[model samples]
Target: MSTYRLSNQGLEIAEQARQAKRWKRQDEKLARAALVSVATLKRFWGQQPIRADSFEHVCRALGLEDWQRLVEVEEERSLDFPQFAWDEFWVGREKLVVQLSERLQNSCRVLMLAGMTGIGKTALAEKLVLELQPLPNFSRINLDHREKTVEFSAIATQLLETWKQQISDSDRRDPQRLLNWLVSYLQQTPCFLLIDSLENVLRGSEQTGWSEFIDPLWVQFFQKLLAVETSASTVLLTSQDSPAQLVELGQRYGHLYQCCVLDGLTPEEQMSLFRQIGLLVEDPVVCDYLSRIGCAYEGHPLALRVIAGEISQAPFDGDVQAYWKRYGDEIERVKQLQQTAEIEGPHDALKLAQYSRNLRQRVRQRIDRTLRRLTEEVPLAYVVLCFGAVYRRPVPERFWLRSLEGRSLDENQQLAVLDALYDRYLAEQVVMDGDLMIRQHNLIRSIALDHLKNLQP
Candidate 1:
């Protein structure tokens, strides 16, 4: 059941009503009058979530006629946005939301959420746009429309024509003029633009090695946006790969551009997600079992959600142990191996595998597409990833480089390949024993190990 608290104005009105009724201000007295526990009374007064029934009783106790009137209203969104399951699936990233919100409001002009597929970049971007609603103008273009591929020039022309009705036909026909009109209009009119699946518009095939814009007009548009001394608008992009031009522009205009790389959910966050989805996490044994699954997946959001759904359904019926009883063998073995690796060293750690073959199709397919792209475009980076997966725990940068010593790459080329792995969010950085090290997620390592096997000796 959903819970709610009093609105700010409602709280003030409730206080006045209480005083008019000549009620004692003591918490004990109020709790007795409201017929709720002191904890519930306190929760009501503190503006924390309380049951609707409890809230109504408290409101009646204060002589307020309408309890519904006192409850906070839902936030109103002014702009038209595609609907998403924000309340259901969105969890964690609280700090990230605050950080990005501040940057977008104050300093940052163009922001990008860059990460691997299924990493929730699009979800987070949608969340940001929703939270910042009621703006004067808002527009979004999803580049993932395979049925009708969207072009940069088309996007710019549409925005210009819609926002500036008086735009000359000649300007809309000319790419440079169309971009200039859009940029100039944006500089004056404060707006929020969200572009999703930007990689669809990028040159990411085997020939291009990822990141270059398919349409040169996009490069010019972004350059002009960031190069401008000031702009009244901001744009947010979600992409599987970071745009090379944006990276270079970020170097030149550091203050105006920001790129946030997303990773998997934390263990604590994963537990919250499991509980939210009706999994039995209250039991310590069950909690521990789920935690191990999280470790096995390395807190991958999609994988954890899939596993949680399985446990919450049918014969399992939210019985984590029962789910474990069937699927726990591999998790148990991985747990033991991880413990041994901490002492025996990473080499002793067995190569981790993906989710059991039967259950991993969705996450597997998603990750497979990304890995296939990497394998085709930047084989050197892909090779580094395969070699680096031999370590079960985070290792130093030198070790990743050391694995490539036999290859033809020089120092600079090797470093670039390592950077490429990081840029694509394939390699993760962690601090262990007060020293920073590199590691790969279990799922990625599983696939990488498979690729490593196919490499010619």
Candidate 2:
């Protein structure tokens, strides 16, 4: 059996042209036969300019329809991965998929997927398309590729070949007309269309660009699609952010679903991901420490991956303190870079010495200011907090608030200080295990501690 196939109409036309016995003019009849043969070849393969005479002679000797049909069937089939593959990809966003599917299933001509960076929203959208890939008329357009520009006319051209329609010159050029033809094609054929990274088209520019041309064109095209009396066609769009105008239109028409916010993985999911990524830890102590850091960082997949990559290359006998020291050095280098341009002084032999002394004094004063806020007496609490931050884990509030004897703080004073910190946006209170937990962002904590460590009386 041949792997590709032509439509029955195409096959019949080719057969009749081949079997034509009465040649009123032999040359004209031969030319028509050659034209039919070329059409068949172009239909099976894509548009290619080749000698029609040779193709016609071959088709006359063999019935190529079955071979063509089989080839087409095989070409349309999707591939399945090996069963033993690692499958590091995400799974089980059924709720979000169903929500999107329902919106696509409803009156909305388009559905948009929006989420934060690195949340796996694109994976979910691709998964949905994979689910729908078996459908005959389904097609996808990836807008992320620089070489491709998606216009209604281009979409219609791809659809024409996929649907095996007779390409009329008029149908190929008119976007509005082509869109109507596409809607009709989709209605009868039940096609699923996916437009990925649609944020590209939605981005506006100060100069004339795609946002000026494609945006309004797609808007009108979608409006026309919605107005059409169709039941089966669906268009799914994936973007980083929701298109404001489209969202407004969807709201007015009550066709949009509530946007789903994809968040970082849960602790259990993060563990599973780590295992999949080939990080196997048998030591309970090390595992517990890494897990604490992971939880503190909100189980953000990228951050966990970075930490895992660092640990995987570090010496097996290396301690957590060594890792902290290495990371602290890197942080100090970054701090110096950040402060370089902010430093200023005069240039004279005596003045230069005085300027250097003044700069050192100012640095000490900054350190003192940071330490004073953390504690009045020892001023070492800031140093401990900074060292703790290098581990990328939240320090327990009691660790910072403990007295010289290491006793827990009185509730009233603790609450007052916490309230002040919250007001100043220095620390945020997170709820964990039914208790108020205090934590600061990693960068701020780093700066606070770096200053405290440099402080001298």
Candidate 3:
């Protein structure tokens, strides 16, 4: 569909109209009306114009006649968005919350949480943000890989506005000046900063100032800030891999930095989430089904969330067991898709080549990155990855041990291959009836199996 973006003037009108009508706090409502995500709306609030159709939809939602009419309203600059506010229905993790709070309160200036995909790190970070006081002093920046423009200056400028830190527009665009101002602001006013998907900053190709110099330089600036006597109240980061720079800082200044490797939710928490999401909780058989499903998915939060959503929707009509029997495998693949989420712009049959190219790039890039790395680093691990892909069920220790037939690796070497897979978050380990079993996500297995088939010659 053709999209519309709100001009600077139109954005101001939307913001004023939203506030005057009490739609500011109703973010989900505004997002639905605009046909976009809350994060997308937050971009508009940050003065980054919205899509054409989205602008019209938002204008209509806010009782404005049209985009042209919205532009007639004077621009409003005295606005500070507190970002997204979600009504959290989280279950369990009281102890973890207490620990996180204590770490931040103490001398720990930077707290890092690392874990496998869909382990609820981001959700917990949002919860901690909500629990903080002086909500205006707290803000989050999601370094989402999908966005076309995610410059450090853009984020820093938005943050300064949110925090009411006065800096010239020209000065805010300069990395050194921005960091200096940021350190000064933190020293005077303690702020809680939560940055999610931090690895995106470090992983991509050399593109812009942020990708090459500014990002690495920003780290050095933070290193100095952390070393100083006066520093932030807390800086939190969540990512799949731990930044080695921060790890070293944590080692040197143990009191100033802390890293927490998150684990999957407890069985109780998983079951509780399913029940709270309005699943078929009353059914006795549903409980048993959830228990099995939960274990199969390793109690990953996103997997359970998708399952809860699927069962709660129509056609199934609250028949949890029926849905389980029919589309359990299909439902499991949703988790994999989420890890490598992508947005496909409108295309046509006339653009068949373009469409096929986009399709191949999306399908190949996700797991191939890791597979190529594994093949180079450890050939044995690559073989294990390929051979193990044939089995859909969780492979037992003996089954994996036997798969080393064509490969000449010893048993210990084979076990190390499994360890490498788990380390990369490509595989998961499960304890089924006290027996350790290894499993990969449904789509992940399919990808590896396809690659293996191509190399069969």
Candidate 4:
């Protein structure tokens, strides 16, 4: 869902209502009565973007909650954005949004939206924020593992920056003091903090299946944050792995904590979203194909988006059928990725498989296809990815270019390949200290390394 600005008539009405209010503490009263922040009430009057719920509360607080009560002869529409306008884009998640909004408004102080990468966790977080508009101090922390601190000082620093508050260097130097300052601030004012991709900090060894990636200080910080009872604040975390402490806390204090486990989209959502990206249509002939694509990718939004992006790019140029025809050879691999979610039929092995088996296979297939295609089309890029994966952190562009020594391709070819991979979302590049640093996702890196390992035999 999305927020909308108020209409001109609505703004005028709000102004009139504000002037007509006799009580000096009217704003405070309305805020408490409607569960809307005073600043948000101001934004509504200023014709700014606001949640639908906020709009309703503002209207009700002004005694014009219903459109029929207002003399809106000029503009027929009271609300700037008609209902379900932007919501049309997010398919089949209306109920989820409603539930999430209710939880945030009611009590779930710390909500964790957990799912695999590219499963729309971040998108949902953004949508929820737009729909609920929790509070003023909203900060989205995209967790990066490259900058490992002794005390996760970066996360704390980012949160403080978002809140526009300052802390002494001495306090920041000490982890416990910084955390205490943070908790104290949240205790004072409401805040919405979304920590995305927490797995970077908490993920265990991929091969061994349970190895902590870094010092558990960040984990401890999250635990402390989650345990706090703040009515006005909500901390949302999106992770692949949900820490047991968070779950246990949620179980004990259901109102203050919630662990939301997300899965792939339904077939309808897949097709609806696909239609937006020009990947699917309403035709009966295409219906089966679209449904199959949905199933093959198991309605993973990122996987579908990648395919759509590739189709819109060069070689295919928005020709979905042509793109399929050109790379149709990879259909076998696609099917291979879709195949066998579990060990076998009617076996105890199949019972032991996690629900994310299909999604992991889907991710594996995506990385695998990219690797194999790069090997044939852009071998230099393939080499770069392989070497970049060798280092867990982001690799500098210079390193990749230098590593291309004695190879047939030059720097330009490597750069072009890198661009293609980055654009396709297979590779990620960041600039640190004036040099471009590139890295792949954990799943992609792991799969790519495994592919290399298998080739050695």
Candidate 5:
């Protein structure tokens, strides 16, 4: 779909017409008459692109007869979006898709999807973007593949160079100017922006505290985006943990910013996904077995996908019974332990056992990256996570905080470390018996317990 803005002459004529009709910038009555948002009204006055229909709405609202004469069709800016291949039949998250779609269209300015690795945040985001009826101009950046020293300035430079076509050398050299220009440009130009793996740009090592942006400018960029009340643009961020800084911004500007914590698929969703992957979930025994595996992994998409592929491939050939005979023990072990209390938990820390070699490798790689960052940057958080693995069920926050007792940390510092785990999504909060509780994912607990012995005193 095409987008249109106002030309210099059109802007002048529209302003005149609007003034004659007593319409003013951000006028609620004008917005209601046009059937558009206040942001859309601002976009109209600012000469930023809006949908052709919305442009017509504004023109009609102003009592302009020649809408075509007042329009300036914007030249489409081609963006290099990431290549994603999705299944023909998407499995689930029907409600999430609807919620995100509506939010992006009407209300949300900065929406973040935060979750553990392989939890399907990116996949769901991709699905939403792909299915957008009139896909707007969009761009994406993979923040994970970058050098540690690279700052937001470099990214700003590339964006300015790409969309704006030309920028002064001084602007490119000055981080503050570049940031200002970029923010201003986004405010006046409607575009969908996606930043993946935001954690990579964060100060996530033991040397640096977790969840703060490594580059201070990044913090400023988000702050500006959230503070702005008039914007036609939307930003989507996918991160393993919601940065504490961004979370604070969301708290302050709750109307403009939102964070969704992605979790595992539901049981029905899990079964649908398995069936789509050509697994024989029709058999009652096989269906029950697959559900057990789903329970074990908490229906983690990537892990479930890998296991399904393994079950469908050569040696097993869609035979769940055969696959279960081999890997069922490992899955059952987790299910059993997860249901047990701390008293009945495993005596020996569960050693790594292969369910599917591919599943283990992928889950481990993703988990290792987070753990390594914790171990390097916030060792206290890492220690806390290791200690947290001892709990089979969700426990009070005090338990995790108390683990750091007798250490050098003060109450504030101790709370900060525990929050670090929460921010990283290594620990999850649950409600039990009307009280809030916390626990780690089964896969995370298994790995953490094995390494708890290795942690220093």
Candidate 6:
């Protein structure tokens, strides 16, 4: 019984040791992962070296149960970005500004905003900085211009210059010391820091050199800025892609707010935007049709603007179908040119070379594969479906199937083929009259018909 009791105690001791070791490992990892040197970390932690107990104490103080949770919280905080006004170009994302303003007023540490290109992410960021300009403590650093390559040192220098210009400069030359002093100052009097167009900085790094992309100096600067406990200040960042590194920095320093992904406009918003653009559409039928097609185009503001421009220039002549057909052809042509440029390379010389080599190759492969899959040779039903697509109207499946009596397909088989086409993105499915209406985009339809005509003897 005594031996059993001794074994149990040993087991408990071993488990406790294991837990302690795990905690120590995590603490070391977090310290190393931070974008700062030992000295900086020591300074941030009040000149105390991070031992196992001290690390645990720090974790406990931050209310983090584990290192992973701490990391996650940090990442989440860094991804938060303030909403700006200029983001009205895209659909469905104005609420972000209100949320950001609330957070800013509450003195959130970091906000990161992520969105795709042409989504007006930059414009929103700019507007946020403009709004924050009235505050004496507000300062902004816009890293948008492609020509400018900003490093940590450069950014630090800019911050110092901005500080000196706005306030005063007692000590200016030493970046490290200046940054330290700035952090101490910010802790006392909070300020807003805006980092705009991080994509340009990341891309520039890839083009120039990875070493140049995220300089150690910048990392240290961020680390220092983050370490400062400022109740009044918030850092806002805007990027096209995920700012993983920035998030990491935020984790090491302070709380990272939620990330907002700005999307395109709603149907109502698109209509409002059209009205703002000064497009006149008095007829209810035409307006409804325009709204339907506009919504169908995924509420992309730029596409709506393009459609609006086309409509304004060429007023509809009492036939909605004719108007759509005319503009559709022009849009398809422009799309084709754009696609060709993208696929063949942006440079004219390279594009010509690529186009010459791979002309009709993909289309031919698709045709050959499709032909092999069909049980009979070139069915008339398929031909009619393809031909109707050229009209840019949803053709009823039953009408086309009945039109080809001799080449009639099993209903299930016909549905399967349609599904296959849709899956391949070669066709689009729309609902009309409570029936599944399959139609191809004008570009795809034009290409398909051209291929069919060429196949004729």
Across 1-457, the per-residue lDDT of candidate 4 in tens digits comes to 2355667776676667767875233354455445454556566566666665656766776777563333333333333212321332355677888998898877777887876556777778777877874356676667634365434766676678668777778866887776776777776788777777665565323222221436556656656666665546678777655554455567777767777766678887877666654443566755565565566555767766555545544565555567556544443233443244631111111110112344346455544644664565445566666655545456576654654677676556556656545533456677888986876554455555555444333
Model 4 Cα RMSD, 1 decimal: 16.9
Better of 2 and 6 by TM-score: 2
Local accuracy of candidate 2 as per-residue lDDT tens digits, 1-457: 1123434554554455445653222232232333222233444334222223334333443444333332223233323211111122243455766766656555555666654333455666666665544545666666665357656577667766767888778767677777777777766677777766665565422121112224366776666556566547777776544454565556665553344545567777766554433344445765565565555445545445545444444352224345445443443343343335432111101110012233224323433343353453223333444433332334466644542223354566444444434322345567878876666543345445454345423
Q: Where does model 5 exceed 4 Å of error?
A: 1-80, 84-86, 146-149, 204-210, 339-354
Best by TM-score: 5
Q: What is the C-alpha lDDT of each candidate?
A: 0.74, 0.47, 0.61, 0.58, 0.77, 0.47
What lDDT score goes with residue 70 in model 5?
Answer: 82
lDDT of 2 at 293: 53
Whole-model alpha-carbon lDDT for candidate 6: 0.47
Which structure is stronger by TM-score: 3 or 4? 3
lDDT tens digits, residue span 33-138, model 6: 3312223234223423222333343344333445332222221221123443342223344576667767766746667676543345666666666455565555
Evaluation by lDDT, superior candidate among 1 and 2: 1
Residue-level lDDT tens digits of model 5 in 391-425: 77788988777668898776677777877887888
lDDT ranking of the models: 5, 1, 3, 4, 2, 6
- The runs of at least 3 residues in candidate 3 whose Cα sits more than 4 Å from the true structure, single-residue gaps closed, are 1-87, 146-158, 166-174, 204-214, 328-424, 427-457
Worst 10 residues of 3 by lDDT: 344-353
TM-score of each: 0.74, 0.47, 0.59, 0.55, 0.78, 0.46
- For all the candidates, what are their Cα RMSDs to the real structure? 9.2, 21.8, 11.6, 16.9, 16.2, 27.6
Model 3 compared with the native: what TM-score?
A: 0.59
**Which stretches in model 1 have alpha-carbon errors above 4 Å?**
1-79, 84-87, 145-151, 161-173, 204-210, 341-359, 398-407, 430-436
Candidate 4, residue 111: the lDDT equals: 83
RMSD in angstroms between candidate 1 and the native structure over all alpha carbons: 9.2
Provide the lowest-lDDT 10-residue window in model 5: 76-85
